[model samples]
Target: MEISQRHEGARGTISPSGSLVAHSSNSKLRPATLLSHSSIRTAAKEVSTLKWSSDSANIAIVSNKLVEVQAVEGHAHPTRIENGSGSLGRFVGADFVGRHHLLTSWEFGRAKIWDLSTGKGTDLGDLKTTCDEPAWQQRPESTGDIRTVALLTRLAAEDTLTMHFPELSTSMQPLKLPTVDAKSMSWSPDGRWLAVLDTATASPSVYFYTPDAHQYRSYPSAANLEGDGCLGVKAINWSADSRVVALSRYDGTVVLLNTITFTPLAVIKHTTTVEQSNLPPHQQTPIWREAVSASNERSYALASQPVSPPLSRTKPTIEPVELGVAEASFSSNGSYLATRDERMLSTVWIWNVATLAAHAVVMQHSNVRKAQWHPTRASLVILDCGEGIAYLYDVATSSAPLAVNAPLPGSPTLSWVHTAAESKLAILAAARSSFWILYPEGAESVSDDARAGVEVGGELFEEGASEDSLLDILSGRKPALPYEIEESYTKMVELEMGEADEGADVAFDDTFREKKKADTDAVDPLDDSQIF
Candidate 1:
């Protein structure tokens, strides 16, 4: 194929025949927006649920009433596993081995090993779905509530992956559980531990399990959970480093737990009722005036006003921040964390992992269901904002996203692959029949320094910081300065108006001159000579 190129001096475009044409610019692509998209459909069945493994190149989608598997690089057709029919198919943690995943099908009353590579599934069996233990049957009065069903996996020393399903002993058939209707279950990144939440109990306990050793550990989170969690935890996401797992409870509490030891990191208190507390002494100040007794009957005017009855405590309605922790995800590089609220306001919260403090929040209109940091450009992240739209957000700028990229074939599971050689591609589970293809529009080929600049916007403009600290602020956590917002907004407005302004046409220029002359003709009392 003969490739043709045309250069238009400082600004230009080239169309090459049968070859990918490249554009080089002294400045990065303006707006850095999602220009266009193509559609792809999945062929298995309607994908009701899906899970993307961190390490693997496959996505486990529960379709056709079975667990459907597709390789990240594979074509539209998925290897369908017909087992787990009529069961609530759950994608548990993927094993350390190749594309093997731990799947729990509530209908089958068992967890299964799904070999994505072989398109096969092995039943690991069930736990007592109900708390119907013989010990309880013997002493009916003392029978406690059997709460949850969980599946945990551990890789043995010989590399064989073992799955654990907690059981309640029975006489006739061991009354194997129908499977635990868990509130939430999360696996550590290394796949060494699993955490389960039992909402059925009076005080739900967070259980930890290690399948390799065939052991179960429970946390002491016996906080009398009040609300009936029938809908249970909507979502759960582990911190990038796997040191923390954020859980979103139905009752509106986003619980953060240290993964190593089941300890509460912070119980972020949230209530629909916005309460106003008394202002601190330093913050509360009253301006006063000196009273003068002029005559016998002195009239004194109050100068500084008394603090207005500490603004009436009105219930400020803040959107429920806790929408079940599962709705959030950590960046591949572990620099930022993101989640969405009940009101559909998706927030990308960039953090300093070392300090665990939030640095920035990228607010979007749609309720974001999934988000991941670009594997190569750690500061570049993409979000699946439910309703067919996906957003590519540069964690660094206040400018609204360059452009909102939509997944083809509609709502598909979006994921990222961080291979050493692969271009950071967005794998979207296409229309239940295909996987939509997405590649980084502009972030793919940029250097880390350039990417960092895009990620942090103008944070690099600050003075007196070390190179390391500057890099951190550019790609890490640095509160945005007010100027950044104005600058980004200005740039966005300019981009919308078109980067290269054609200048005013003759007719427009004539109108502009007339308007200018009319404005100049307005009366000026101060200087008559200048006014004329």
Candidate 2:
């Protein structure tokens, strides 16, 4: 199947296989057109993973059988790489080492490095790692240098974490961890800390360490003391600033940690009290009311509702009830966080970072397959719900989200592509037969009216802005201008209708003299004319 894009008057139409038509407009924040590269094709039946290069100029799509690298620009044909002899494992994950080379890991702990220019693969031998996947360092931008890669190898008695520096052709000595079975490991965006989650102990624990493998702290997961089985951790994600990390547990709880202090900031539990209670009084039955009352102890209910019993009175009675596996992610600017629970797969909870409270909640009709914030846009979020249409949520704008229709078959996955020209969203179909690229026509700037409360003393104060502003300003680095500061100073002043009188003039003269003396003492240097 092939996808085609055509323009008709002010609207653009996308026709795939001559059966589906998606219309787009330029005046609103909608996808304008679709672009599909014809030269790239997958040999396997489905795509297991899709990853963009560090430079964002190419995308690597790995299938269960093979790997294909396609250039984002031009009409260049895709380069295909296959596994070497005696390696009988399927590809699990892949990462770009630099701009020119690719690292692909497979089952049974086998890996290889492929040269894109020559399409040749070099075996790295068996890694014998406890986890099938390797954790690669994430870079904000392409740095034209080899990135540091890490692998967790399991020994006979203990587990070891090793760092590999491809540029220097050297590997760090294996750092033995306290746990015997390490499930997975990840590195922070700033590359200052490493996190390892192990499940071998009686209760799962997450360990934090420095770059050199010095263990500083460890936090154990809260036990299901109410007799519910422990589900353990499902995933780990780091914030853009590297100051906070989110751990998504299988028991429908999300734990936020402060990397600097190594302490738990908050624990979010998934509950249906708020959602079910919002319905009309007729819909709330006796059974629903009982459930709501039982959930009052653990749910993060809205603040406007009547406060529940204090923690001191309800601490021992509360139980970490099992809902389902949960997923959480932070926005680009770290101002908002989004989460979804498997039990309520159609609902998404958005939390404000400054207040650590719920900002907005969204509910969809189908199961939400993926929800991600735009790479550059702070307020805009893209979501796919196993349907033909994609939803855009602008939390700062309207109460309801906007939709864009692209009728692709099977479940769809979404990823944002950051190119030099513009930012595009990639929608990969489940069949692996075709994929569509969407160009957002226009994006509305978040209004300053919503942030009027935080605008103080001609400077906008935000949760994550203060830490970097002083350092950047002192080092002569220019900071991006805020939307609130774009208005002119003259427009902010108000004038009274009546004219001034002699009495007002006399008061102004005295006030002006007092201000002048204060300014001189504050700005002028110490001199002989000044009194001690």
Off by over 4 Å in 1: 1-107, 110-123, 126-184, 211-235, 269-326, 344-353, 386-389, 396-400, 405-429, 432-436, 440-532
Worst 10 residues of 2 by lDDT: 523-532
Best by TM-score: 2
- Backbone clash tally for model 1? 18
Q: Give the per-residue lDDT digits (tens) of candidate 2, residues 85-181.
A: 3234677878887777787777776666665654444545455555623644432332464456666666676777776655554567887888646
Q: What is the C-alpha lDDT profile of model 1 across 1-532, one tens digit per residue?
A: 1111112111111111101111112211111112221112233244444444444344454443444444433232334444322333342222222234334344323444444333334445343333221001000011242312233222221111223322222112221211243343455665556555544442345566653324354544445443553444444567656777766555445566777666767654332222223655443222211122444221212222222211112355664443433355676666666554443334444454545545344444444567767666666777665655555667655443433445244465565534332443433333433333345442355554443322111122121121111222334344323212223322444565663456543322222334446545552121111000
**lDDT for every model?**
0.39, 0.54
Measured over all alpha carbons after superposition, the RMSD of each candidate to the real structure, in angstroms, is 28.4, 26.6
TM-score to native of every candidate shown: 0.44, 0.59
